[model samples]
Target: MIINAFILFLSVALPGLLLTRMKSFSQKRIGYFLVFAGAYLFSMTVIHIIPDLFLSEEDPFKLGLYILIGFFLQKILENFSNGVEHGHVHSHGGYSIPYLLIALGLHSFLEGSIMTDSIHSNHRPDSVYSHGSSPKILLGIVMHKIPAALALMALLVAQLKNTKKAVLLLLVFALASPLGLFFSEFFGHSDVLPERYLVIFFAVVAGSFLQISTTIFIESDPHHKLNWKRFSISILGALAAVAAQIGF
Candidate 1:
């Protein structure tokens, strides 16, 4: 679990740091890649996570309710995050730095919590071939994080006079998700909470995934015109999501 958390931490932090050095990197180019990530996240949630959650014959309706809660929870988080989770960041000067950090941190933390179910499944012998959420979800998160971290670092650099201070703030945001994962793994193993609760939590995360991905697809091309490149990338993403489920 620690190893997995560390990988996720790097995924969240390293890209922004690298972006700071790559002066030639284009946000528009990054935006194209983000479309692929968004599509994969949406496809994975709908193809894998949601079906797994609804598979529970017991109180399936309750799982749906939790998903709705998660969807709204993300909407509220965006009020402060400025849509950073979906790669939306602006250089506007009037925004509150503290509020932005808090919102991003909370969203990252919730994202990490979604991994607990995967961790638990890894410990079960029978789950080896079971249909469950794939670790590829981590890949999707990391893919999105690269652009998110870039946007965040850009915002921080624009707002703070000191480079080191901006980097430090970025590091804080990076740690939020891994910290959430670590805590969730610890508590999950302590046997304090029932496994059923974890399922509901996963469902909630799925809801958030749905909301973010759909928003990205809709907003990525505001003109609503047919763009073959993006459309093909999105199809590829969905294919990748399906392939991941088949032990790719």
Candidate 2:
């Protein structure tokens, strides 16, 4: 669990911290990477996570409704995050830092909550990892986080004009996800909690994944014209997801 949380933290913070110094990390390059991450995430959610959710005895219809709620929940978060989860860097001046951080933090927290080791153990009893074979979901989140962290740091540095302050904010955002996982693990051991609740939680997270990934695909190329490179990268991303499913 600590290893998984550490990997997630690095995924969400390292890229941004490194890219801030490079100066040549263009948004266009980030967009291409975002497409790949988006496709990979979408594929994992559809091919792995959603199917696992259905393995539960819960009503599929109600599970789907929770997905829809999660989808909209992400939409609401995006309004405050300025679409940071999808790699959008807000340019408007005078944005509220507290509001943005809160939204981002909440979203990250939910993401981390879905990555419980106990849940993974319940779902994949035969896996070797302590957390089970849910690396696909974890990898997807890490892939998505790279560009998000980059965009977020860019915005924060621009807004605060202080490297120390920006780094502090990045640290806060980075910790949010791991903290979430800790809290979930802490509370999940209680006897009163039903096993099906984890399934519902996963379904909601899958819904948010759907929304974010689709948005990345749609918005990555604003012109709506065909680009073979982007399309190829997207396909490669899907293939990568499939490979992870089979290999891991």
- TM for candidate 1 is 0.90
Per-residue CA lDDT of model 1 for 74-186, tens digit only, reads 88888888787888775455668999899888888878877665434533345423434437768888887888888888878877967688889988888988887887777
Deviating ranges (above 4 Å) for candidate 1: 91-93, 118-134
| lDDT scores in order | 0.78, 0.83
C-alpha root-mean-square deviation, each candidate: 2.4, 2.4
Instruction: Indicate which candidate wins on TM-score.
Output: 2
Return the TM-score for each candidate structure: 0.90, 0.91
> How far in Å is the alpha carbon of 150 misplaced in model 2?
1.0
* Predicted candidate 2 versus true structure: per-residue lDDT over 1-248, tens digit per residue: 79878988998889878967877677888888899999999998888777777766789999999999999999999888889888888566566789999999988888888777565555545543323444777888888899889888888888899988998899889998899788777766765678788778768888998999999988866789878899999999999998988877
lDDT score of residue 209 within candidate 2: 86
